[model samples]
Target chain A: MEPVTTIHGRAYPFGQKNVDTDVIIPSHWLKTITREGLGRGAFETLRADPDNLFDSVEFAGSPILVAGDNFGCGSSREHAAWALLDLGIRAVIAPSFSDIFSGNAFKNGILTVVLPQAAIDRLIEVAQSQPIHIDLDSQTVTTPFQDRFAFDIDPFRKTCLLNGLDEVGLTLAQGDAIGAFEDTVRVERPFLAVGVGS
Target chain B: MATTHPRTLYQKIWDAHVVERRDDGTCLIYIDRHLVHEVTSPQAFEALRLAGRTVRRPDLTLAVPDHNLPTTARRDAAGQRIAIADRESAQQLAALERNAPAFGIRYIGDADAEQGIVHVVGPEQGFSLPGATIVCGDSHTACHGGLGALAFGIGTSEVEHVLATQTLLLKQSKSMEVRVEGDLGPGVTAKDLVLHITGVLGAAGGTGYVIEYTGAAIRALSIEGRLTVSNMAIEHGARAGLIAPDDTTVAYVKGRPYAPKGADWDKAVAWWRSLATDPGAVYDKVVVIDAAAIVPSVTWGTSPEDVVPITGVVPAPDSFADASKRDAAAKSLAYMGLTAGQAMASVEIQNVFIGSCTNSRIEDLRAAAAVLKGRHKAPHVKWAIVVPGSGLVKAMAEAEGLDRVFVDAGFEWREPGCSACLGMNPDKVPAGERCASTSNRNFVGRQGPGARTHLVSPAMAAAAAVAGHLTDVRDMI
Candidate 1:
């Protein structure tokens, strides 16, 4: 995972709540095991439209996306996040996101920004043709046209992304603590110490 | 020192289980069961390899190959026909077999008698039970919550989490109580009951909460019916849905292959009984529904909430306050060739599929077969197929002559597989075709790329098969 510090990109304003993963990459694209070919299928239906966001020359390589409430609902397919990343999405601005999808985006180093519905509606307006700026340090999203969209994110996921660390990375960072806990548990509850998580 | 008031069930469960908390407030909670399938495991395994890791607990994790596997027997429904159509992806099943044991996870491959949808296989193998946390790489993981457990789906990285650490750090969820009271009508099924709940409470009604279903109506449903109710909680935006385990639950688990035997079984039963919420357990929210009021249901538009009773009419555009919603409804109605205010039962369907984890059990088959006993499927319809959930279900249906009635009714009695639920296999709707399905979702393109799906009851799907259009099952009854 790359340490994504700053994101400067255009926004694709998709105004729909509860955008499920099934629509992100259909089952047909799931047949292959490789991740390379999926970008072509990212938002495949939206891409199929001649008037789609990707078709607009100005937003073709945009790194930010502005979506409506409840984005990324349904299913546990991380390919939905993978497809967005493959298409160069660095951050997603939505009113809310499905819990599992948010966890997935964080792990894959794709930033998920949650704003109020009003902030989201404003971002949708500013995202068209205007370049959006996202700073992890300030935890704020702003557009070049004087539009500022401040959002909240878990402090933990932010640190992990800033340092490019995931669950494994976090575990290794706690190696000393884990080792100590194992030793203590051996004396406290011998039956569980040998296979703690098992 | 006096402790404060007792915690709610969700809070109590969340508090006792924190493994660790990081700088960002993310807590790593222990996971009990890790379920997987062919569709998502390959990538997670690759991630493990890239990190130079091995599976942490092989016994805790289980895998089944179902999503893209063949429903028919190898020889009769083998690659000959599918090869001509989907030749490139025909070896998807073979790939799963090659990959599973290499990862050292237990794999139940094609035609394994005990194999079915990962969600279905979990309970049958005693992997899903009371007071446990289970994670699967499928949205329907919430289905297992019916057995008084906390279970929900996770993404690929989370899949990797359990594969390596068998734990997930999740934010705690608020609790909600949705109590559906009253008795179900003779023709109503569990599928109808769930669809009706989503209809009244919009799709996102249960957002950010763990919905615990209670009341006489819910308690009366069979373990299978309760499973169906919790299965679609994902459709309602609930993190997980649970029903307290009771005697019915104990009976369902008594003699299964993975269930404990004799003294162990008594111990398991006692533990399961102790897991239920004590009398007067407080809840964060509650909603009551009338079961008798809910008939066989069918969606009329693009979303799950665009539903009406089988005998009711489609809502006119003016019936809604939001213009955009009304416009979307009108567009979906046009695509469905249904007129405003037209009886929803009059809308015709070209396909009727009875499968998916929601309605692919032996009871669902028995219910549908009882309806299709003497009549053939309407000749105008292009397809009507009955795909059983597992081999055992298929064998049972055959033994009871249910398969014959489905076949004799001009419906294709296909093999056991996921079938058209997600349209991963050869079974799917032709582009732009309309289908009446007993599957959980009615989202646009869920059945296929351009296919339209109407979520309905298995009995309603049967009646539609016999009439060639959506109609109330009560009319046949």
Candidate 2:
């Protein structure tokens, strides 16, 4: 994972609401052995439309996606995040997100910017002709027309995002304490210890 | 004044799992049981291999193949149960079998006696114990919370992390209490209760909170019924749903394959008994629902919350207070092929599917078989099938001759798997068809492209299969 502080580019500008993980990446695409090359399957259903925004050159290679409320509302498939990352989307601006999808996006180095619905609407409109800007350090998403929206993120998630700390890195940071806890559990609850007295 | 301390069941489990607290109010929580399925674990295992890492505690993890199993074939000519049908599914299951040994993780495939839906197998095998923290990459992991465990879904990234380190970094979720009082009326069930609750709370109501289901009605339910209620907690938008362990829970877990024996069992039961929420415990939110008020419920729209009692009518979008919700309702009505103000009972169906972690238990099978007994499916019904939650459930159902009853009733008595739930397998409602399903989630194209699903209880689904339309199970009973 890489640190994600800022994301700036033309957003997809589609304000579809309740867009589930199935629509993001259908279950058929989930059969793959690897997460690579998922961009082809991202929005496969929507991209089937001749007038789909995802395939439109105007939003092609967009680093940001401005969406509606309850985005990523179904399934715990990390492929939804993987597909978005593969499609070059670095940030998603929505009114709200499913907790599972939000966590997946963060872990995959994709920023999920939760703004008010009104702010999201404005961003979608501005994204039609101008690029959208997101600054995680400032916790604000801005547009060229002097439109600025501040958002709040969990301070812990923010720190992790800034530091590029995956769970492995995070856990390794508490190595000594984790080691001590294991020793105590081994002594106190030997039954719970893995492969102990087996 | 003396300080009064109140702790919820969630808090007790959270505190017990906390290994170390971070400055951000998050803690490293030790995970007791980690469940995995075919759809999610392949990538995580690949990541572990690439990183040259091994599972920290393989004994705590279990894997099964369900999402892609063939529900049609129980066994091949060689007397071995079919693990998968298609090439893609085969690759995923093969990966689990190959990876499990290398990591020392237990792999339960179709050939295994304990094989079935991951959620169902976990509890059936006594792996989902009370006061424990369980996790899986699948969102329905919350289903284990019925046994008084703290379980929730995780992403593949977290799955990989758990494989490497048997702990998850997390902040404790706020708690909510849902109290259901009074005895349930005849023909009403945990499915009806949960569907009614989702209707009142909406799909996103449980988000960011871990809910404790308490009160007389919840306590009165059988272990299987409680599991059904906790299984759909995710549908309420809650992170997890829990029911504190009682005598019923202890009875169900005792003597199982993984359950402790002798003195350890006594000690375990003592600790589990103490896990109940303390009196005067204050929750962030509390909802009281009268059990008598709930009727046989059915979902009428794309979302689980878009539900109504069997006797109720489809709601008009204008009845909603919020404009966005109103629009969403209208869209759902269109996609579901329903009219505003139309009676839900009048809707016809082509397929009836009764299987999922939500309602595929042996008890659910018995309920449907009871409804179908001495009756045949309607001539107009195209297809109806019953998939058990696990191999054990399937074997038990067969032993009771429930399979014969279903077969005689024109319902396919299929092998165990998550068939037609998410349409990852071959059993699916065809496009443009209307189905009365016992599975969770009625999302558009959930069963198949353009498939419209009406969520119902197993009995209701059986009744619908017999009537060739939406019919109340109460009438059949």
Q: Which prediction has the highest lDDT against the true structure? A: 2
The residue-by-residue lDDT of candidate 2 on B1-477, one tens digit each, is: 122487889987787677888787979988878998878888899878866778888888888889888787757799975655588878887888788878888888677778999999989988778888899988899889999989999877888988888888888888999999898998898999999989888899999999999999999999889988999999999879999999999999988888767766777788788778889889999999999988899998899998899999999999999999999999999998899888888999999999999999989999999999999998988989999999899999999999999999998888889999987788888988999999989998999889999999889999999988898889878
**TM-score of every model versus the real structure:** 0.79, 0.83
Candidate 1 colliding pairs: A156-B24
- Report the number of the highest-TM-score candidate: 2
Off by over 4 Å in 2: A1-28, A39-77, A80-165, A183-198, B1-4, B80-85
**lDDT per residue as tens, model 1, B1-477:** 222555444554454345677676777776667888877667777777777877766666778877776566654445443332454345555555666677777777665677888777788677776656778888899998877778898866777877877677677777888888999989998888889888877888888999888888888988888888889988888979998889999888767665556665666676566556556777888898998888888898878878888888988988999888888888877766677888887888899999888888888899899889998888888989998887778888899999889989988887777788886777778778889898888766678777888888788899999999898888888
Residues A1-198 of candidate 1 have per-residue lDDT tens digits of 678788987788877888889877775677666554577888888678898877688788788888888888998777888888888888998888999788778888899998898988888878765778999978888777787767777887889988888876676555565445445434532322222123
How far is B197's C-alpha from truth in model 1 (Å)? 0.7
Candidate 2 reaches a DockQ of 0.29
Model 2 chain B, poorest ten-residue lDDT window? B1-10
Q: For residues A1-198, could you state the per-residue lDDT of candidate 2 as single tens digits?
A: 678888888999889999999999997787897776799999999999989998897888999998998999998888999899889998998999999899888878788889888898888789899998899999998889999899999887899888877667678677777667778665544334542112
Candidate 2 docks at the CAPRI level of acceptable
